[model samples]
Target: MQHLDLDFVRQQFPMFQTELGQKIGFLDNAGGSYVAGAVIDRLTDFYTNYKVQPYGANPISNRAGEAMELGRRTMAELLNVSADLITLGASSTQCFNTLSIACTPLVAKGRSAAAGEVIVSEQDHESNIGGWERLCQQQGATLKIWPVDPESGELALEDLEKLLSNKTAIVAVTHSSNIIGTINPINEIAALVHGVNAKLVVDGVSYAPHAWPNLDVLDADAYVFSTYKTYGTHLGVMVVREDFLQELAPQCHFFNMPYPNKRLDSAGPDHAAIAALAGIGDYFAALHDHHFAGKKGLPLHRKARAVAALMNQHENELCAYLLENLNDLPVRIFGRKTIEQREANIALSSPKISSKALADGLAEYDIAAKNGHFYAYRLLQAMGVADMNDGVLRISLSHYNSLEEVERCVAGLRAMLG
Candidate 1:
């Protein structure tokens, strides 16, 4: 298809057919996206048929093991990376925590030549920052802040350069800000971090939903994202580069050290959630088939890339429309006023009404949105937001969201602001 077929795209998600779902315009997609029908089917099938302990002697166990392996492989395939590099956990926060523990030798005081330093961006979600902070505290290592432009809430490459030194062991940041919606230049950041012999860890939770992570090109030592935000089950995927993996202290059981994928997987999340991830691959394949021609021979990751292009294009249009309308309103948009270098996600505050009040008004109109610092508390605090609790109203979007939904959001905001 020349453009994303919105009707066909919306149908893949079962939520749009429900009573409340039909009534409400779902703009709070950054929190979590509605599960695709394929994902639901796989999840239900797993629970009903083979919910036994996997990789055991029994046939059911073998089948369960195969299903779980397929799920893991699907994630690796989507990212175009080796399956052994992918580690699944409860959530991205858990993954990052495990990764930090794994890096104890690199960050700890006597273990390294000097008390190692770590840099975390001020614009990052707490999931990416807090784990490293706690790790540094325990290890007596220095934790440097890569400050954001207080007015724009955007991180500067120059600030990160100043923070990077030979003492820097790790530089953790987000692929995109949940509140500001700005997409950081990961490649450039990676180059700078690598130049100083520091490893890069990117939290891709917000960016993955809008644009699938191209791990093939992203030069980070580690990358993490949540499946729940990508229209699948709740699971965090962490992909560690082989060289980087060897540098970290083993995070798993002694016997499990041989297994590359299990090295950083401390939290063995639900088996069904792992099995259900194959459905995300299924969902993307279906979209690719519907939109493009003769991609059957192509690999899953390449097909996903093609499908993501369509999704990104459609979302950019919706975002542009939303920004244009909101520009005339009495609201202060936190990030770039245009769609450039941003996702469809948006955050704003209005002088006429509190963010909480604006959110409440939108709820009356059946438009889904919420107001909070959204775990980007440091960024909002730097931006001079008075109340972190009532930070800003975030209207996050997904591929299934339509122009009509954005219009409803704008109209609701107009009513409340006026």
Candidate 2:
């Protein structure tokens, strides 16, 4: 396999050319990534040419509608699902709230002698956990916990299997933990959840940037991720299996129930943001072409997989280097000890200094790092970090980050600690 060209990859993102980018070492990619130039161009083009209401017979309206549809189709192709199965919302938090409400009736239907059960991981962001927990509370259902291992920061499949029961209506988990950065065995979890006749909902927001999830391989009932985190516009893209889509009660108006895709999104769609999401396809295609020149005739999903493979390899290298340096320090690192089982989103705490102080010091070296629970409040509490205000220092990296940057981050930390 060909290695990713760092120079070419950096060129695609206009942020690196900006003054702040030129000075600061941006390691907080897990929070969000720099938007690609292609996405920006698409957004601009939409506003310039098709700034009217979509889906009408009028020329501008038709073009606007077509652009929005193209974005949905391209994103669906990236995830290996049908365009109608994809729903674009304001954000993943909003989408899950809408989804949980829609799925409430389904859970109510499954309720019998025992309260209809909903199992959620302590390892997930609040965006994933809160909505489901609230839904369970509202319907007087039993809410179960699939707890994570506090020490290793990993979730066990055996624990998940024990939680599954015939009354289980939904099992919500993360494709990868944002704080821990360990990639959970989603397919295995999906199988266990499905065997018990429960639908699986996954939060792919953290994992999507590192590697695009193939919903076909995952077999989740529904998967959610934000486009902003995946080098595109600011929108949350959700993929609901057709079977489950029809089962959930519509959150949209009565007229939209006929259209399964529109049923989940209650708010007015952001026409420009939706249209710009198609640029993600363009960005991936460009990456594929740059790395695998003259290799044509590959489908969009295939090309995405090819790009993801290279990106993951490069990210693993950065993760290993960062872990090696941290291992030598007195800091307590979260997640798997090996790079093979984790993404580049690393969280750690130093015994000598507070998380905030360390992060502040790193800033002095022009490194952009963050310190907080990062919305993984429940997980932090479970890990014995009672105080959310003083959370772990996070150094999240992306494929665009170079080995040189990793070395610089390590040096920054060492200087601060010493």
lDDT of 2 at 53: 88
- Each candidate's number of clashing pairs is 0, 0
**lDDT of model 2 at residue 47?**
100
Candidate 1 residue lDDT tens string, 1-418: 4799999998998898899978899999999999999999999989999999999989999989999989989989999999999999999999999999888889867435577899999999999999999999888888999999999999989888888888999999999999999999999999999998999999999999999999989999999999999999999999999999999888888899999998887868999999999999999999998888766777999989999989999999999999999999988999999999999999999876899998999999899999999999999999999999999999998989988888899989888877
Expressed as tens digits, the lDDT of each residue in 1-418 for candidate 2 is 5899999999999999999987788899998999999999999999999989899999999999999988888998888888888888999999999999999766774346666799999999999989988998788788899898888767989998888888888999999999989888888888898998889999999999998897778889999999999898889988999999888989888988888788897795689999998899999999999888887568889899999999999999999988988988888888876697788899999877999998898888788899999999999888877568989999999999988878888998998776
- After superposition, the stretches of candidate 2 with alpha carbons farther than 4 Å from their true spots are 109-114
Worst lDDT run of 10 residues, candidate 1, spans 107-116
**Residue pairs of candidate 1 with colliding backbone atoms:** none
- Judging by lDDT against the true structure, name the best candidate: 1
- Candidate 1's C-alpha lDDT? 0.92
TM-score of each: 0.98, 0.97
Error of 1 at 196 (Å): 0.9
Q: What is the C-alpha lDDT of each candidate?
A: 0.92, 0.89
